[model samples]
Target: MPLHRLLYTSEARLSDNASGADLMVESIVAHSQANNEKRGLTGALLYVRGTFIQALEGPLDALENTFERICHDFRHARLTLVDMSPASERMFERWSMTYLAQNDEPARLLVNRDLEELYFTVSTNAAEAMRQMRGLLLGEGKKPALEVV
Candidate 1:
């Protein structure tokens, strides 16, 4: 079956506190992993400077339902669907939901480069940007340590 990918960026409504952010990340990962695994979905989620950039891949109905839940999620605000299209294959096949807490220079640089253009304009290079974002999240040769609830 053909895969579908949904990439979105959203402003986080929670306060930026060390413990709070950590707890929120844990909660999100735990919840997402359970749901995505059950639905046979896969994705990566990145949180940086009170912003969330996520890419989810799966069947069309599952992806759409997941996006709908995200749209109504209280933790997110100003949620923008950055890109949605048919994907030839899954970019994150191993992870049900990988959570990356952006704290490094490379992630910062990539986010700076892409988020502005992605959030403001309808760029034809959105797919490339999404690919780059996925790379930045998963490229460091180290998988993010997602806490199991």
Candidate 2:
């Protein structure tokens, strides 16, 4: 199976309550972790301002099947595929699903940027999207100079 990577953005259809939204994201990450582990898939998820930006990398077949399920998931609306292409190696090889939430330090770094603008940037530039996602994961504990435009 060849390695492949996919990037996408979507509107989160969760409740207005912050706690409720948190629970929903938690559930998503937990479920994704289990499924992706079994399927030999790895990815990172970024949730901010009711929008989700994710990157999935693994076997092309696994990626396709997983994305099919995501396409039908009710929690996501207006899902826009940003990029899909062959990958030499997995960008998120360590995690089945690395969840970066709104309150997370990485997310806080990006909070100053407008959600729509960030979405547009990622949608147009896959390299930028991967750099930002990887930066978010790498910047968990220490400060990494990450600028998202």
Best by TM-score: 2
Query: 1-149, model 1: which lDDT tens digit per residue?
Result: 77999888888877468778788878888999999999989988876557787889999999999999999999999998888999998888878998765454663555444445443432356577666556655544444433312
Best by lDDT: 2
Poorest lDDT segment (10 consecutive residues) of candidate 2: 140-149
lDDT of the candidates, in the order given = 0.75, 0.81
Query: RMSD per prediction, one decimal?
Result: 4.6, 4.3
Tens digit of lDDT per residue, candidate 2, span 74-111?
99999999899999987888899977654545645454
Model 2 regions more than 4 Å off = 104-120, 140-149
- Our tally of clashes for model 1 stands at 0
What is the model-wide C-alpha lDDT for candidate 2? 0.81
